[model samples]
Target chain A: MKKYNAVFACLLLVLFTNSAAASSSLEEYFYASGKIKVVITVAAIVLIGLFVYLQRLDSRLKKLEKNKIEK
Target chain B: MKLWLKILCAVLLFYALLSSFYHPLAPGGLTVDIEKLVPGANTFVYSGYNTHFKDHSNDGLQFFVSSGSHYYPTEIIEVIDNNHAKVNVVLPDTLPSEEIAFYANTPTDGTVYIMKPMDISAFVFHQNYTNGSVPVKVANDQHQNFGYPFQVIIFESIRNLMWHVPMWFTMFVIMFISFIQSIHVLSATGRENMLDSSMIYVQSGIHDRKASASAETGLIFCILGLITGSIWARFTWGAWWTNDPQLNGAMVVFLMYVAYFILRNSVNDEEKRARLAAIFNIFAFVLLVVLLMVMPRFAEGLHPGKSGNPAFSSYDLDSSLRMVFYPAVFGFILLGYWIYNLRLRIKILESNEEI
Candidate 1:
C-alpha cells in the first residue's frame, strides 16, 4: 500500500507538470498527405492475417495442453 | 463450424477488406496559407485535401468568408494542381465578425471548409470600400457525391473504425456466449439425471469446455482490440493512452478477465472450479458492459460516442462506409466463433481421456 501510494503521487506530479508541454508537439504520424486508402487497406489485411495466425497457434497450444493433461 | 459458414466468413472478410479502400472521401477540408486577414485584397494559397480541384477548373469554383448565416464571396485566381489552388478575397469596410471561417465550393468538389478559422481583425487597415450587406446563405451549387466525410483531426484515421471497433464488437459477442455457457454449467447439476449417467457427465464437461474456450477466444479479441485502438489513439489523440473514461474502463475490463484466468487456475476440484468461474464470468461481463459502454457516455472523453464528442453515426460512417463496416463486423465475429470452437474441441478431447 505504501509503495502504491508513492507511485500514485509520482504519476500525479508527472501528469500535472507535463500537461502544458505535451500540447506543443502535435501528432503528425500517418497523416498520409490526404491519401491513406492504400495504407488503411494494407494495415487491415496485415492485422487480419496476424489474428488468423494467432488463432492457429492458439489451436496448436490447446492441442498440446490436451495431450499433456491426458498423459 | 459449417463448411459454408466458414467459407462465407472468409469471403465476407476479404470483400470488406478490399472494398473499404475503394471509396474516396468527399472534398470537405481546405488548408489555407494565411491565418490573419486585413481589410483589403488578400491572396491566400489554398490546398485541397482529397479533392479533385484541377478537374473542376472549368466549373465555377468560388470561395467565401462566412459568419453565422452570412457569406462574403471571394475570387478564385488559379488552380495549381489537382489538389491545390490560389484564391483572392477582398475584405470590406466593416467586418462581419472578428474571426470568420473559409469555405470553398466547386461543381465537382462540393464544399470544403478550412479546419482553422482565420482572424479578420488580426491586422487592421483603413476601410476604403464598404460592402453593403453580407451575402446571406446561398444554396451550394455543386452536388455532393457519395463518399466518406472528411473530418480535420481524424481525416484518415477514421478508417480505423472499420478495423478497431469491430474487434471489440466481436469480443463482446464471444464473451456473451461464454456467459451463457457458464450459466448452463451451473444449472446442469441435477439435470444430469435426464440422460444416461456417463452421457450426462460428458454433456456437463462439454458445457464447461465451451465456457472456458469462448472466454479464451474473447481474451484474444480483447487484446487485439486494445492494440489496434492504441495505434489509432497514438495517431489521432497524440498519445497511446489518454485519461479518458472509456479507455480506463476498457483497461479495467481487460484486467478483470485476466483475473478470471488466474481464478480458474487456483481451484483443483472440477465442479467447484466450473461453478466459481461461471459466477465470476457473469460478474466480469456485467462489468464489461457498464465500463466499456454505459459509463463512458456519461462523462466527457476524447473518444467519440461520449458526452462531449459527437458520435460517428451522425456523419462519419456514411453509406459507403456502412457497406463494408457491417460485413466486417459479421466476418470478425464469425472468425472469433471459429477459434472458440477449436478450443472447445481440444477441451472435449482432454475430458474424454479423463473418462
Candidate 2:
C-alpha cells in the first residue's frame, strides 16, 4: 500500500509539472502522437505473433499424439 | 471458415473504420473562423463550409453563437451565401478558464461540423444543417483533442447487411442440404425396409425423436441472426422493436422454426416424424423468403432495401469496406455449415444405439 502511494504521488507530480515542461527545449508533446502510433503498432505485432505461436504449439502436440499411436 | 477467424476479421474491420470516424467522401472542407469570435463579441468569427470554388459544390453548416455560454436560436440573423452567415448579438466576454458550448446544427453534410457529436445519442441534440463537411474528429474544448482522424464511409444501413442479410444465406444453405438429403432418401428405392426408414440416419433421422443436424444448425443461425439483428436495431434505429413488416415477418419465421423443433419432438414414430418435418422444412423456407424478402419491399418498412430508405444493392461499395464485409459474411456462413455437420454426426450416433 505504501509503495502504491509513492507511485501515485510520483504520477501526480509528473502531471502537475507538465505546465512547467514548456521551459525545456524538447517539447515532449510534439513527439507524443508518433510515439503513441509506434506503441500501438508494436503491441499489435506482438499479439498477432503470440496467436501464431500458440496455434503452432497446439498443432505440434496433436501431431506428437498421432505419431505415438502409429508407433 | 472458423468462428475465431470471422470474429477477428470483422472486429478488425470495425476497429479500422472506427479509428477514422470523421473523414468523408465529398470535396468541400470545414473551416472555423474566429472573426473576433469572443463573447459579448456579437460579430464573432464565422463558421461555415467550403466547396472547391472550382466545382461550385455546397455543403451547409450554419450555427448561432453568443458570449454568455447560453445559446439562443435568436442569435442567427441571416444567411449571406452558401459559405458565410450573420448572427444576433453575442456577449463580448467570458469567465477565466471557462468553456462555453456554442451549438451548431449540421443536418446535411460534414462540411459544416461545428457542433461536436460525442456519441450516437448526441447526434439527436443538434439542429439539422444540410451539405456540411462530415466531421473527422469531434472537438471538445474541455479535452483539447483537436481534429480526430476518423475515416468513415457512409455505409448507411448497410452495416445491417452483416446481421440481417446473412441469415438468409445460412438458412438457404441448410435448406439446400435438407433438400438434397430428402431427395437421397426418396430415391433410396425402399422404406419400411428399415434402412431408408431408420430414424438412425444422422443427416435426417429415420425413426427416432432426434432432429436432423441440419435443423439444429438452422435453428442456431436463425436464433443468432434474430438476436444480433435486434441489437443492431438499438444502434441504428435507437429502438429494440419497430413496426417493420420485414421485422415482423422474420419474427414469425423464427417462431415457425422453433415450432418445427417442438413438432419434431412431440411425435414418437421416427419415419413419420422425419417425413413430416422434411415437408414442413420446405414449406417453411418458402414462407421465410416470402416474409423476410418479398413482403418488406411491397409492404413498406422502416428497414432498408424494403422501405427504400437504403439498400446495399443500390449503392456503390467502397473497396475498403467491401474487403471486410464480404469476408465476414463468407466466414460466418462457413462456420454455420461446420456446426450443422457436427450436429448431424451426433444424431446419427444417437439413432444407432436405439437398436
Candidate 3:
C-alpha cells in the first residue's frame, strides 16, 4: 500500500505538473520519427517505476507471509 | 480472472463494436440525399436547396459552425435533400453553369456528381440545335472535378465511458460487498473476528487509516468520471455543463456518495463507522440508480442515450460502432471489479495479523 501510494503520488506529480507541457514534450517523446531526450527520459521512468512497483508488491506479500507464520 | 483484465477486454470489445458500425461522415461520397453547398468564383448560384438536413447539394465544401460542445467545428458540409436524383441550383453561392470547374479531396462512390459533360450534355446539345448548329464533334478532354470523399470524424471520447463510469459502478459494487461484510461482522460475533470489523468499515488493521476498498476506489472513480465527462461534454455538447436535468442529477448523486465517504471517515468508532457506512452505501446506490435511470426521462440533456433523443438511438448506432463500444463498457466494468478485489485482498492481508 505504501508503495502504491508512493507511485500514485509520483504519477500525480509527473503527470499534472506536465499537462500543459504534454503537447510539445509528448509529441517529441512519442512522435514516430522525432528525435529528442524527452523520449529516453520517459522510457527510463516507466521501466524504473515498473521495477519499483513489482518490488513493493513482492515485499508486501512477504510481510504478509511472515505475519501469518508468527500468528 | 483479474477485474482489470475483464474491464480491459470489455472496453476493447466496446470500441471494436462502435468502430465497426459507426462510420465518420465522409465527403465526396455518394450522399444518400443531401443539398450541396457550392462556392462562387464570379458566378453566384447555389446548386442545391437550403436546409439543415436536406437539399441535393454538391460535396467537398466545408463549413465552420459552433454546434454543441465544439468551439470551432473541424468542418461540416450542409445537406438538404434525399433523392439520389438530380438537384437544384441554390443561388448566391454556386457556379453559374453546369461546366463550372472546382477541386476537392478524393471522391467516393457516393459523392455529388460534378456538373460536367455527362451532367450537362443534354442542355448543351439543345442549345446548339436551336442555333441551327451542325452536330459538333464530341469533346471529352477535361475532368476538373475530383471527388473529395465525405469524412466526418466523431469524438472518440465515448471511449472514456469504459474508463470512468465503470469506476463508479465497480466502486459501488465493492462498497456493497464491504457493506455486506461489515453487517456480517456486526451481526455474527462468535467466529467472525470482531476485532477486524474496522477493515470493513473505517480504517485498516492497527494504524493504516485506510478506509474500506469500496470507499477509496469509489472516490477515485468519481473524480475520474467528472474529468472525463467534462472533456466529453466540451466536445459533444459545446459546453462543459448545461441545464440538463440528468447531468445535474448525476452530479448530485456523485456528491451524495462523496459525502458518504466523508461521513465514514469522520466517525472514528469501529462499531459506529461500520454500521453507519454500510447503511449509507445502500442509500447512495439507490439514489444513483434513480438519477441515472429516472431523471433523464423528465429532463432533457445534451446526452444522447436518453429516450427522446434520436441521436442516441438506432440511427446513430450503425453495425460498425456496435463492434467496438459494446466490449469497451464490459472491459471497464471488469477492470473495476479487479481493482476492488485487489484492494479487498490488501485489506485482508493488513487485517490478518492481530498486531
lDDT of each residue in B110-183, candidate 1, tens digit only: 67777475565554333342253355444342445556667786766566666777888998999999999888
Better of 2 and 3 by lDDT: 2
Score every model by TM-score: 0.83, 0.49, 0.51
CA-lDDT, candidates in order: 0.73, 0.48, 0.44
DockQ of each: 0.15, 0.03, 0.09
**Model 3 per-residue lDDT at B140:** 24
* DockQ score, prediction 3: 0.09
> Higher-DockQ candidate among 1 and 3?
1
Better candidate number, 1 or 3, judged by TM-score: 1
Judged by DockQ cut-offs, the docking class of candidate 3 is incorrect
**Number of clashing residue pairs in every model?**
0, 39, 77
**lDDT of each residue in B1-355, candidate 3, tens digit only:** 5556765665664564344334332232222222233321112121321111233235433221111111111222333343223322322221223433321221122212233222322232221222211222221211232211121212233333334444455555554555555445445432336556544333322212223665555555555555556544544455668777766876887788678869877998756665576667667766776786677876756565665654322432233434444464555455555555555576667755543
Model 3 ranges with Cα > 4 A deviation: A1-71, B1-211, B316-318
Q: Judged by lDDT against the true structure, how good is candidate 2?
A: 0.48
Give the number of the best model, judged by lDDT: 1
lDDT minimum window of 10 residues, candidate 1 chain B = B124-133
